[model samples]
Target: MTEIIKAESLSFDTLLEETSFTVESGSTSIVVTGKEEVDACLVRLLLGFIRPASGRLFMFDTDISTFTDRELSAVRQRIGLIYASGGLVSNLKVWENVVLPLAYSNKFSREQIEQMGLAVLNRLGYSGKLMALPGHIPLFQKRLAGLARTMLMDPDLVIYESPLTGLNYNERNQFLRIAREFHLEKPGRTSLFLSSTPEIVPLLEDARVITFTQRQSS
Candidate 1:
């Protein structure tokens, strides 16, 4: 099996325990860490947002710790991150936030990205106003908006952080369905969900579950 993500003895500032696991390509994995800190820290580490205190992290067979800034950016562009809080820039409109990353990359013209942003959001069943600021929208819309941004990137690996936390059954099911179908769209697509809820295990079909509890400090 091709390994998409591998962590060897990875730990960070006592927030997370020494953890090592491999997520193979085209597989789904759920990492349920009861502690919010540990869950967030682990996601950040995997996304290369923060450095691990010790050990190593490898993404797509490249050691992220050893990568230069330019190399790391290239790697990250291939990964999508869906935050629990929608991860929008508060000051920007929903449309702007949705297209922010793509706009920054400068891969497409402004008009092209603007069209793609709204198109994906609508395709994902988001009917909210694109002109509205993030704080003005409901949680479900916020979640969808963030997901729409991810879809624009067409990432090979998608990392979800507490995707079902505050949503109702219908909303949760819709989100899960969209995410699941997205992962299945490509044979080599991989997904990793970091959540604190044990109930999520059943929601993720065929996912390899890994339960993590933070260690007590001495």
Candidate 2:
């Protein structure tokens, strides 16, 4: 298994420290900090959305700290982000949001985007109204739609930010099952879940977990 993400003594603005770890290809990594701000910083650091004040981070073997603005944007294309709220547009219908990126790219015809979106949503077991707004659907279905949207892009890496924040036990189990199955579908695919609690440790299986309880600065 090749290393997909590597962090060496990674620290962020006195918010996080001792973040050294490696996530191998085709594996899952759970980072638990039990602090909302630190967890957000970790997500930003991992996604290249922000840089660390100290230490190093490498994604797909590229030094994130060294990447230029344009280079960082390019790297983000290979990554997918799932938020606790499903990160859908409230004004857009579920179907429209499912292919929002494709629509923004204008790379495909309207019919083409619709076909792809509907197909992926169906595959994800989203049986809600395709034309309904996000607020009109169940929370789980909203997330399923978000997952479908991410899958349509076929990203090499997936970052989940508080994915199970509002979910119940059964929903979390089902979502985990779906996420694990999706990760296995692609060789060398890697997934990272950021959480603000250690409680999630028991909910996972066969995952590499890194916990930071102290905020130390040098």
Candidate 3:
């Protein structure tokens, strides 16, 4: 099995340290009860946005710390991020947000992109919100649209940062279902949930778990 992420003694500021772990391909992992700064720093480190303060961070056997911005950009395309804020362009409609990355790469024509966007939204249990402007849609649908965008690319690894942060009980269950279905439907697509809520951890069945409390020394 492929190793998607491996970190050893990772530290960033006072938020993280001695955080050693490995995530294999097609597996789900969670880091529970993480501080906000810890979550942000971990994502930054994984995405190669910032260098780690100490220790190593590797993505698919490549030491991300050694990569230049250009080198890292290649790897970034294979990693998908579901952001806490949904991260959709406010000016774009829901469908537009879903297809923006595809459009940028010229991987599909305008008509093809539209169909692909609609198809992904449908698969994620959404319909009829595609034409709605981002500001016009509810926050839940906006987040779903963001998820559709990420899924359209069929990325190798998907990272969910506080995925259940603002959701109510039912909404949280729905989101978890979608995430589980997405993971199970594909082969070799890994997932990492970085959340501060310990309650959300056990919900992801069979997931390897690590906690910020375990990484920090008293």
Candidate 4:
């Protein structure tokens, strides 16, 4: 199997120590639970946003620690990250938020970008809210818009950060269903979920779950 992500002996100021795991290409894995600090640290580390104090970090077998800013940016384009709050631009409408990345990348013309954005949202069952600002939407729809944005790029790896927090049980299940929709449709795409709650673990289909615990101070 293709090794998409791997980290060994990952540590940061006692928040995480000796953390190791492998995420094979097309597979799903959940960082089941961890202290908030540690979870954020791991997400930043994986995205190459911040360097770990120690250990090896790899993306497709290339050590991320050795990557330059440009190289890391390129790597990031292949990864999709859904932040704790949806991460939509406050000023941009929902459709604008979804297509911004594609438009900025210059890989497609303006017409093509809009068509792709609409296609994604339609697939995810969003209609008539494309022009609405994210702040005006309900929390569930806001998150769904975020998922639509993430899906627009058809990223190689998708990372969801605390996607279920503050969601009611039904909302949480809907979120998982959306994720599974992607997984089922794109069997070759890998996903990584990071959260401090373990309740969502059982709902992840065929996911390899790992929990990161902070070491107690001596």
Candidate 5:
């Protein structure tokens, strides 16, 4: 498998200094922070939302920091992100939501996009909501919709931001099972990067944990 994403000595400073350990492709790694807050800077840094102060970030061997918007869009087209809040377009129906990425890339035929969306939704037990607007569905189902959207494109990498958040134990377990199944089915084709609170560590031992410690003032 190719090295899809890599980061070296990623760091940021606002009120405090925050650093992330280097990460490479085909490897499952987690970032845990001592602070209660999620480090949006680190997350954005890795996702190419922002540039690092002085470090290298590569996607498919291309330096992401130097990529033009069009170039970055091409790279992002190959990556799927399941945001912390289930980044669904509230007005869009489930099917529409699933096809959003394909629409952006202009790579899928109408038939192909529909088939892909339905296949993922069916696998996630969400077939009934194909025409339902996102706001109408329950929170868990909305999250499932987000996952479906991410999975529909079958991208090389999927970055999930707190996928199990706001779920009860049973829901979390169900999501994990589905995620594991998805990973196994794809084998080496798709890699996953998950971010969550430290509390989830025990549940996800299969992942490499990188705890983020806040740097103190000199």
Candidate 6:
């Protein structure tokens, strides 16, 4: 498969000291040369949430630093993300949350969006919770809802931040199963970027586990 993202000699300074890393597609390799305070920024850049202070970042063959907000939005339309908190609207119903991005973009008809949401919800084992509000659902269900929301758009990449947090062992296993299914179903159609603390290493062994493993393996 062609590389979808590549970063070389990237450097940035957050609240603390300078940090640096180099990343490429196909493998979730990362190198952190500074304190832990800058980890969040590194995660953000990998997801295209923000630009690096210096160095080259390419998305699909184009340099991301060259894109304006409008251009970045266009780029983001092809990507999906599940924030650490799921990023669901508390006031929106489950169905609405699943289709919210498409609604915002006006990319799909109402019927099309509804169908897509239903299909993704079913795939993620969330078919019954479509009418519940985000606060009403259990954490596992919320995570599934978040996964549905991320996948509903059929994005080329899906970035998940601490997705399995606050879940029980069974729930964590279920989430991983769903993620594995999603990846297999897509088969390189979408790249999955997940961020979590070091404690989750064993759980994420099947994945190209980026965080500390990069250092160990290197």
Which 10-residue span in candidate 2 carries the lowest summed lDDT? 209-218
TM-score of each: 0.92, 0.87, 0.90, 0.90, 0.82, 0.75
Q: List the residue pairs that clash in candidate 4.
A: none
> Where in model 4 is the C-alpha error above 4 Å?
none
Give per-residue CA lDDT, model 4, range 81-192, as digits (tens): 8877788899998888888888788889888887888788877776547788888887777777888888887898999888788789988887888897787678679988
List runs of model 2 lying over 4 Å from the truth.
105-107, 135-138, 215-218
Error of 4 at 155 (Å): 0.9
Candidate 2 clashes between residue pairs 3 or more apart in a chain or in different chains: 34-196
lDDT of each residue in 1-218, candidate 3, tens digit only? 78889998887777776678888988999987456557767888899878878899899888987788888998999988888768789888778888888998887888888788878887777754677788887767877888988988888899988888878888789888888888887888899998888888778878888776554356
Evaluation by TM-score, superior candidate among 1 and 3: 1
Worst 10 residues of 5 by lDDT: 15-24
**Which parts of model 5 are misplaced by more than 4 Å?**
1-3, 13-18, 34-39, 103-112
Candidate 2 vs candidate 3: the TM-score winner is 3
Candidate lDDT (C-alpha), each: 0.87, 0.82, 0.82, 0.82, 0.68, 0.64
Arrange candidates, best TM-score first. 1, 3, 4, 2, 5, 6
Question: Candidate 3, residue 183: CA error in Å?
Answer: 1.1
Look at candidate 5 and tell me the lDDT of residue 124. 84
RMSD of candidates 1 onward, in order: 1.9, 2.5, 2.0, 2.0, 2.9, 4.6
| Candidate whose lDDT is highest | 1
Whole-model lDDT for model 2 versus the true structure?
A: 0.82
Tell me how far the alpha carbon of residue 77 in candidate 5 is from the true structure, in angstroms, after superposition. 1.4
Task: Kindly list the per-residue Cα lDDT of model 2 for residues 95-209, writing each as its tens digit.
Answer: 8888987987878998999788877777777778889999989888888888888888788899888877778888888788878888888888888888886777777777889
